[model samples]
Target: MFKLLLFCFLIGITVGIGLLTTFLYANTSIVNQVFLRDKYSKLQCIWLLVFLTGCSLLLYYTFSSQALYYSLIFMNPSLEPLQFWDALWVVGITDFVVKFYFMGLKCLILLVPSVMMSHKCKGFWYMCLEEISQYYCTLVSTPVWFRYLIDYGAQTSRAEWHFGILLALLYLIIKLFFVFGQWKTSADVLRLFFTQPSYGMAATKRQCSEAEDICAICQAEFTKPIVLVCQHIFCEECICLWFNREKTCPLCRTVISSHNHKYKDGATSLQLRLF
Candidate 1:
């Protein structure tokens, strides 16, 4: 009774996470961990990963041992005794391919959200990934164990970042092809667009003279101009604060009819021209 109860509890916990992971896999809702908000959800995914691997391994050994019993081991006339040479040549390839398969699968859960989220996470991207992961997971038909060995095995220490690297390579190949085509077309368009005779000589070194306008106060670029309603310019920031009340031009010191004045740009440059 005690052991059965423990088993039931573990099964319940696993089912809960399975439901949660499936639901939230696409939900970008914040994981809500104070410091690790963006990353905590991923860390939580560690649970799904453990569950997947354990189930896969258990089912795989069960089926394979039973189905391929004698053929897998005892030397037949064909390929006797699985030995050092077998391990070196045959096992190496098989192991790599199998591991690679799992790593590739790991990429679905690992890289999809990770790469998708930060810069630009789109709904369609997740949708496409879900369809693919589910589709392949279903198509394999073999127990999930086979999928685990092939995909997950490649993801770990056996090939450190194996799937990530492979996925990157695949993307690079695709991007390079797309980029090459785009550049080829853009180059042709650029050639035709720039050939018009109205286009002045390709490269004329026309020199520009810098304006010598200097501020009256700081003597700066006059870069900071405070032109007034009468089109008179002042450097009020450089000047004293009393000018706002003066209602008169400073340089000419002419008393203006009204206190309201406009900047040369036609803006009511009130306090802006003062303080």
Candidate 2:
């Protein structure tokens, strides 16, 4: 039961982090756009690998001493010990690679902030040494927390377990709300464009003229183009992808809206949604 709870906690943390990153990436800023474009954006994949590796390690530690070996021998009376050793070697090497990758990511995350700060200091060497020391200390310190969590679980304190579960559930609820808002916005946008009888499936050349001859996203000739409220045009998929991240025109950075321009109190600015 404790092991099950531990796994649940880890899964919750993974999902919470993923949702947070997705929400942040959905921003219309240049930074987020670049991040989306980059092939190295694989936080979800990394988290999944880490989760699987951790579970394997945990199970290995729990049963490896005698229990696991005896069980394997009893289950397969004719199986050769040499074959077991061969399989273990393969699994061990894969586990080491996953662990190494995770450690590298952790080190990179810690190092980047310190390196960014080092440029502002005159004592460059001292700053570099300090940053290096800080990173090492942090790397070492993480195991202490893991040890504490493991020890706490062994003690089976209900209060701590309950609190952790509550926090994770809260994060999941917030993630659900974010997802709902995103889906609603997308549905509304699509309905506004596709429901037009005259435009129907494709925009006329006159409408297409509002955008450039080429799609900015794919760098190809405009195909199935959609004109944004800002008069900037892009391929239907390309612009939708951009809008999913941010509610703004990519070229001019004008806020996107389906409402026709309106006049009220002499204000001509596009009215942003409260959400």
Candidate 3:
């Protein structure tokens, strides 16, 4: 199984790189269009480069551990140890490379909208929050405008005041807490985009006592766990129902005070809901 997965990873990395490279080379016009639209400063460019490298390393490290964990299963079995070691080597390296390529794909599709929104706004912070709120709302309601609103902060969403508070707090953090504000600028925007993935997935990250990936309410494993801003992952249905009745998150006991529904991207981001 490990060997097969490794082989698949190699194939995926090859295909991903080939596909993205072709897109870049073939559609030079589109590439130029994106650059023109999202013109980053030298500092921002350096930050992005450093950030991507770090994230890639993190992904590689995480998946490598997973690979090692899976390989241990073979050690206890009657499998050929030498063959298994070879398989682990091939698969682990391939997994890292594929993740690298996939990150590039994400940059093309996800980064543009996020960066463009980040740069163009007067209310970068709250707009970021509202963007997250919309993303969270889409997971459970089956509403007509779920995806559209989350990505765009629909007519009903409180994007204006949402962005307002964010901007004000950001200003306060930067002005008063200047020493700890090195990450405030880019972090404000990233906190918004990732807090609510622009896709239809509701992946809020709140904490749950159980690690089984089963919803406490329904006791069903989610097809995709909705990670709330709370660093908790749960069945989307459970959290949605919980959020609707009580203005508090289920696991963390954090008040769901803001109808705006957004937090940052850390354990300290304060367990909050975006959708």
Candidate 1 on 1-275: residue-level lDDT in tens?
A: 99987875675466435434533432222212211313445554455455445543553454343332222232221233333332233222222223223333433334344344321122222223333333333222222222223343353575744654565456456545755655554454334334311101111112101223555555565533445544455343333222323456656766543422111111110110000
Show the colliding residue pairs in model 2: 26-245
For candidate 2, write residues 1-275 as lDDT tens digits.
Answer: 99987885676466435433432332222123223332324564345435544654564464354233222212211223323233333223222323333333332332333235321121222223223322332233222222233333334677876664565456456645765655554454344434421111355687666555788888988867766656667776566445434556778888774332111011111111111
Best-matching candidate per TM-score:
2
TM-score of every model?
Answer: 0.23, 0.28, 0.21
Candidate 2 — which residues are off by over 4 angstroms?
A: 1-202, 209-212, 257-275
Lowest-scoring 10 consecutive residues by lDDT in candidate 2?
261-270
Report the alpha-carbon TM-score of model 3 versus the true structure. 0.21
Higher-scoring candidate on lDDT, 1 or 3 = 3
Q: How high is the CA lDDT of each candidate model?
A: 0.34, 0.40, 0.40
